[model samples]
Target: MCLLIAIIIYFLFILFLSTLLYPMPVNDSGITRYRTIPWTTLILILINTVIFVAWIGPDMYTQEAGASGTVEYGPSPDYMGKINYYGFRETTLHEGIGVAAFTTFTAMFMHADIWHLFGNMMYLWTFGRRVEDACGSSRFLLFYLLSGVIANVGSVVVTPKLDDIPSIGASGAIAGVMGAYLFLFPGTSVNCLWGIGSLIRLPIAVVQLVTSQQAKFWRWTVSVPAWMLLIWFVISSFIPSVETIRSDQDTVGVNHLAHLAGFFAALTIFLFVRKDLFLRYLQGRSL
Candidate 1:
C-alpha cells in the first residue's frame, strides 16, 4: 500500500511540477481494453496507493509495538495485535486473520525503506507489462498473487518460530514470471543488465556479469529447456545462507524457499489452469 501511494504521489508531483514549470502533459496511454486503459492496472495502482498512504499516516487505530513483538497505534483505544515475519512485534490495522498469509501477499508491494521500493518497482515496471501481455491481465494477477502465496508458505515452512522479522518484496512473484517465460515463450528475448565479478571465486560473479548475453532462453535450451531455470531456482531455495542474512533481526531473512515456491506455483498453474486450452493446443501441434 505504501509503495503504491509513493508512486501515485510521485506521479502527481511530476504532473503538477511539470505543468507548472513547462506546461507539458505526462505520458498518456494511447490504448485500452475499450476506450480507456485497462481497469485492472488502474485498480491495482489505486489499491497500492491507498494502502501506501494508510501505512504511513498517523496511527489512529494503534501505536508502535516492538520489533519482535506486537505494535499498537491510534487513540480510539483500539488495538489489534501484529507480528513481524520472524515473530517480532510490528504495527498494522488488520486483525483476526493469519498475519502470515496477509504478509505473504501484502508484503510483495511493501518496502522497509526507499531503496527497497526502488529496486522492486524497477523490476516490476520492466517485467510486468510483458507478463501481462503474454498471460492476459486477469491471469497475470492470479499468477502474481499465487506465486507470492507459494513463496510465503515456503518461507514459513523453513523458518523457526519467534524469528519475527517480516519479509516483503515483489521479487518472488517476478521470479515466477521469469520461470513461466522460460516455459511458455522460449523464443522471447529477455535483456538483463547483469554483471559478474573477478578471477577469484567471487570472480565467477563478475564473469557471469561480463558474459551475460540477452537471448531467448527458451530457444537456447531445447530439451525440457524451460525446466532448466526452474530447477536451478528450486535448488537455491533450500540454501541455509538466507537463514543468516541479517543478524539484527530474529526473523527468517531472505526466504529463498518462497522464491522457489513461486516458480513451481507459476509452472503448475500455467500448465494446469487452462487444461482444455493446453490440450487443444497440444492436439493442434501434434499434426
Candidate 2:
C-alpha cells in the first residue's frame, strides 16, 4: 500500500511539473458507461508515460557536449540516432516511403520531453475515455493511429520546406480525440488547469473541492463546455499556423497545422462510432 501510494505521488508530481507550459484537462463532466472501462485510453497513456520516463527521458541532455547524463552535453548520438530513425519527416514520404509509413505509427509514441508526453496524455485521458466508450476499444485505437498519420501528412503537405525536420509526439492523435469529443459530447464540461508550476496540482485541487475545502488551487481550474474549449484550441492552432507560414522561419516547432488536420480528420468518427450511437447522432437524438 505504501509503495503504491509513493508511486502515485511520484506520478502526480511529474504531471504537475509538466503542465507549467500549457493548460491540461484533468477531468470531464460526462459519466462513463456502466461496467465499461476505457482500457485502450488508459493503455495508451501508460505506454506514452513509460516510453518517456524509461526509454528517452533519462537520456535527455541540453548542453553542447560532455557526457550522456551531464547537463552540459547534448543528446548522445544513440539518442539522436533513435530520433532520426523514428521521428517522422516529410522527406521520407517520398524517399523511403515504407519507413515513412512506419514512422507515422512510431513517432506518435515518441515524445521530445516529459512536458510533451504529459500534455498529450492528459488530453487523451480527458477526452479519449468517452470517445473510446463511444467507439469501442478497437475502433478508437484505429482512429487514433490514423489520425496521427494523417496529421503528420497534413503537416508535411502544409510546410514542405521543413521536410527534413522530424516531428514527434501524440498531440495529433489526442487532438483527434478532442475533435471526436466535440462532436459526440459538445456540451460536456472539461475541467482544465491553467496556472503556473505549483499553482496547478489538479489532483489535490480536485480532492480539496470534493472535501469542501477551498484552496488557492480553485483559481487554477476552469470548467468549460467541450465545444468552447475545442473551438478555442482549433482557433489557437490556426493563428499560429498562419503566423508560422508568414514568418517563413526555418526552424522546427509545434505542428499547429497537423493539429488542425487531425481535428478535421476525426470528423470521420461517424465511421468508428458505435452503430447505435451513429444512428442516434444522424437522427438528431442525444447520444
Candidate 3:
C-alpha cells in the first residue's frame, strides 16, 4: 500500500524534474551477460519466505526456561528484527550465526515477519531486475551473497550485541545490492522513499526511486554521503544507540556501513574485471 502510493508520487516528481534533468541514455553494455536473476537475491527471497512459513513463526517468541536460564520471546512484530525481550534475541542465536557467514546464504529466504519479507522482496524485485540484467547470472548471484557477508560482518563490528541477540533479515545484504547498483550506475535514476506518516511512504519522487533515496539523504546531510549511508546503516546494526535507546519497542534500523563496504568490495571486483573500460568511462565523464 505504501509502496504503491510512493510510486505514484515519485512519478509525479519525475514529471516535474524532467523539466530540468533529462533521462540519461540507457546502456546495455553487458545485455546478454546480465540477463539472469542474481541468485543471491532469489535465494534470499526464498529463504525469508520459507523461514516465515516454515521453521520459525510468530509463536516461536515465547518463554523456554530450563536449568540454564529463562528465555522469553513473544512474537517479534518488527520486520527489521529488533525484538525487545531477552528471549526474542536468544531464540534465534544459531540461526543468526548461520546467516552471519556466507554458508547460509539461503537464510535470506527466511524472514521474521510477513511485512519484513514483503519489503525486502519488493525491493529485490525492483532494483534486482537491472543488477541481474547487467552483471550476468553467476556474478550477480554471488554478488548478493558476498554483499550479505560483508553486511553481516559490518553489523558484528558495529554492534557487538548482535553476537548474542539473534538478528535476522536481508537489509544488510540488500544494502550491498544498493551499493553495487550505485557503483555500476552512479547517475542511474531511482525512487527515493521516506515515512510520511504511519503506514505511509512519501515518494521523494524520481525516475528511479533508489537513486532518489540516496540523493535526498545525502543532499540533506553533508557528513554522510549517500554511498556511506549504505555502509553506515549496516554498521549501526540491530542494536540501538543512545539516540534510539529511548524507543520502547523493537527497532531494526538499516545497517549503513556494511552496505558501503560491501558495495566497495564488489566495485573492486568490477574494477579488476574491467579496469580499462571503467577508467575510460570515468575519463569520458570528466571530459
* Top TM-score hit: 2
List candidate 3 segments past 4 Å from native: 1-44, 58-73, 76-107, 191-266, 269-287
Residue 147: error of model 3 in Å?
1.0
Whole-model lDDT values for every prediction: 0.48, 0.81, 0.48
Give the clash count for each candidate.
37, 1, 36
**TM-scores for all candidates?**
0.50, 0.80, 0.51
Residue range 224-270, candidate 2, lDDT tens digits? 67787799899989888887677655434788977988888887888
TM-score for candidate 1, please give it.
Answer: 0.50
lDDT (Cα, tens digit) per residue for candidate 3, span 54-113: 655644465546566867555535433433222223224445532233333443444556
Q: What C-alpha RMSD separates each model from the true structure?
A: 12.5, 5.5, 11.7
